[model samples]
Target: MNTDIILTCAVTGAGDTPPKNPNVPVTPRAIADDCVAAARAGASIAHVHVRDPETGAHRHDTAYFAEIVDRVRDSDTDIVLNFTAGGGGDLIPELIGTADDDRQIRAAAGSDLQTPSERHAPIGELLPEICTLDCGSLNFGNAVYLNTADWLREHAALVRDAGVKPELECFDLGHVWFARQLIDEGLIAGDPLFQLCLGIPWGAEADPATLLAMRDKLPVNAHWAAFAIGRMQMPMVAQAMIAGGHCRVGLEDNLYLSRGVKADNAELVAKAVDIIQALGGDVATPAATRETLGLRGAP
Candidate 1:
């Protein structure tokens, strides 16, 4: 079992969850405040995703990112900021019949696609200490999260050039294989950082055996973490620590403190900290986490 753990709190994800849980944090100020609160609650890193303040829909606006970055940097908090570079890859396809009765597949209403450079724009400009590089694509709920190998390779190079650590987010065994390939091709700099994303439908399941399987596939030099959504969120925290890996938790992965109790970002992080301490493991500070993962420190 790993005694020293790096706990990350994903403040807000690019999902339509603000209405479901009022504490999801839609505006830039709220998101930044939650990041600071999570840091105070013992989170070493804060994984952030911005949304349209009015609509609460996910947006790729650099201005939004700038505001969040500025707010967090201006605050008294000391935490590693991990901005989301995994946006603009949602693909919802629909088959329609034309006027001539010909059937064709076209992107549906929710499909938001972009080039590698476009998706990497925020990370490139803002220069966060770490950003996510989705290693591969998988069916994400009703839509397919599209991240081709070519795009991943290009994105990896961009992150490397910017002197930012890419959190290799592997949703399946295949993603782990390709992540290793990127390391082999010398695209990833320093030791690789992996996040085993589990429990999202049609991807990897949420269980001990599956987590172990994905964990076993990571490179020996890689610094890794794991998380599961919904009710399994807290359980996976313990499982990840016992299995010798770091872990993440927040409203991004789970909205509940209990069966029906809604939780905010800081609460989720504090709960994870409690679980880590209960398991006889201590939570690593941002400085220690940066040293462990070879991060570029705070940006």
Candidate 2:
């Protein structure tokens, strides 16, 4: 277990969650507020995603990102920002028609698709401390999450140019393997940072053995963290620390603090802090996290 762990609170993600909870923070201002609150509540970093205030859908516009970054930087709380470059890859085939041959090739009406450069535009313009780079494509439930090898290379080049660190988001074992390849290709800068996403349907399972297996595959100098979704969110907090990794918690990954009780980003971050301390581990501060992760300053 890591004695000095970094707690990152993913304040708002591009998930279909605004309808389920009123406190999900749809607007840029609200998201920035929650991100500050999460930092105050003991999170070293805030993984952010922008949403359309009106429809609560994910938006890849630089303006939304610019506003969120401005608000966070303007706040008193000092938290490392980790914006997402993992958008514009959702592919839903159902709307394209259920024909057998058409399912794999056509995109539905609501599909948010973009070139790698387009996806990397916000990261370039805003240049937060860090941004996410999903390593590979996988079956993200019924819809497919597409991050092909070529696209990932282009995205990595953009990230390297921006001088922003990349927190590799690896969902399955294959994704983990490909991340290592990215490092070998010298596409990633500094020591690699990984977010081992567990328990997503058709991806890696959120079990002790699975976490162990994935962690063992990480490069020697790489820094890594692990998280589980839904009911296992809190449990994985202790589990991840016990297995020698950092922790992530927020409304994006899990909605409920209990069976029927809903939680906001700050509450989830506080609970994660309590869990980390209870396990005899100390949560790293933002300054310490920056040094550890080799993060660059805000642009």
Candidate 3:
């Protein structure tokens, strides 16, 4: 165990969990407020994704993201701003039965299926301290999380050029392999930071053995965090800390703190902190995380 860990709160994600839990913050202000609360509760970093304030649909609007970042930066928080660069590659192929017809299947939805430049556009504009670069794609629920090798390489270079540190999000062991390839290609600078997503359907399962298995294959000298969806959230915090990786938690990944108990971002971070302390571990502060990740000035 590393004893020292960086704790992150993914405030609200782009997933379709809005209807299930009314507590998930969708507006920029709500998300920003949650980030501040999480920081005060012990989060060194806040992973952000903007949503359509009205419908609660996920959005990739730079302006909306900018508002959240600005609000958090101006408030009583010094949490590391980690913008989402994982949009634009969303390709929900239209189910227009036959390929011969220029007929459209389902129109492309979600921002992750975009081209490399489109994906990199917001990061260049917002220039947050850090951003996420999903190394590859997998089936996220019913949607095919989309990312190709070429696309990864292209966007990695752009993220590198933007002078923003990227926390590589790896949904599986192969994604970690691709993160290593990004390092080899010299597109990702600094000591690599990785987020191991667990218990996502069709991806890595949320279990001690599976977390350990995927973690064992991490690149040497890499800074990694592990997360499990729903009930596994806080449990994985201990698993990650004991295994020498950092931990991330929030409502985006889970809704309940316990049976019938709904949680906010602050509650999630608080739970992670308690677990870390119980394990005799220290949670990384924003300054400590910035130093450890070697984040450069944003573009």
Write one digit per residue (lDDT tens) for candidate 3, span 1-299: 97888999999998888787877999999999999999999999999999999999888888998899889989967899888888765666656655667666675544345688887777999898888999898987767778899989999999888889898998888998889988998998878888999998989999999999988888888889999998888889988888989999998899988989888889888988998999998898898887788876322
Better of 2 and 3 by lDDT: 2
Task: State, as a TM-score between 0 and 1, how close model 3 is to the true structure.
Answer: 0.93
User: RMSD for each model, in Å, please?
Assistant: 1.5, 2.2, 2.5
Which segments of model 3 are wrong by more than 4 Å? 97-112, 297-299
lDDT of model 1 at residue 39? 98
Sorted on TM-score, best first, the list reads 1, 2, 3
Instruction: Give the per-residue lDDT of model 1 (tens digit) for 177-267.
Output: 9999999999999989999999999899999999999999898898999999999999999999999999999999999999989999999
The better-scoring model by TM-score among 1 and 2 is: 1
State each model's CA lDDT, in order: 0.94, 0.92, 0.87
Better of 2 and 3 by TM-score: 2
Model 2 CA deviation exceeding 4 Å by range: 94-104
Residue 184, candidate 1: C-alpha displacement in angstroms: 0.8
Best by TM-score: 1
Q: Distance (Å) between predicted and true CA of 174, model 2?
A: 0.4
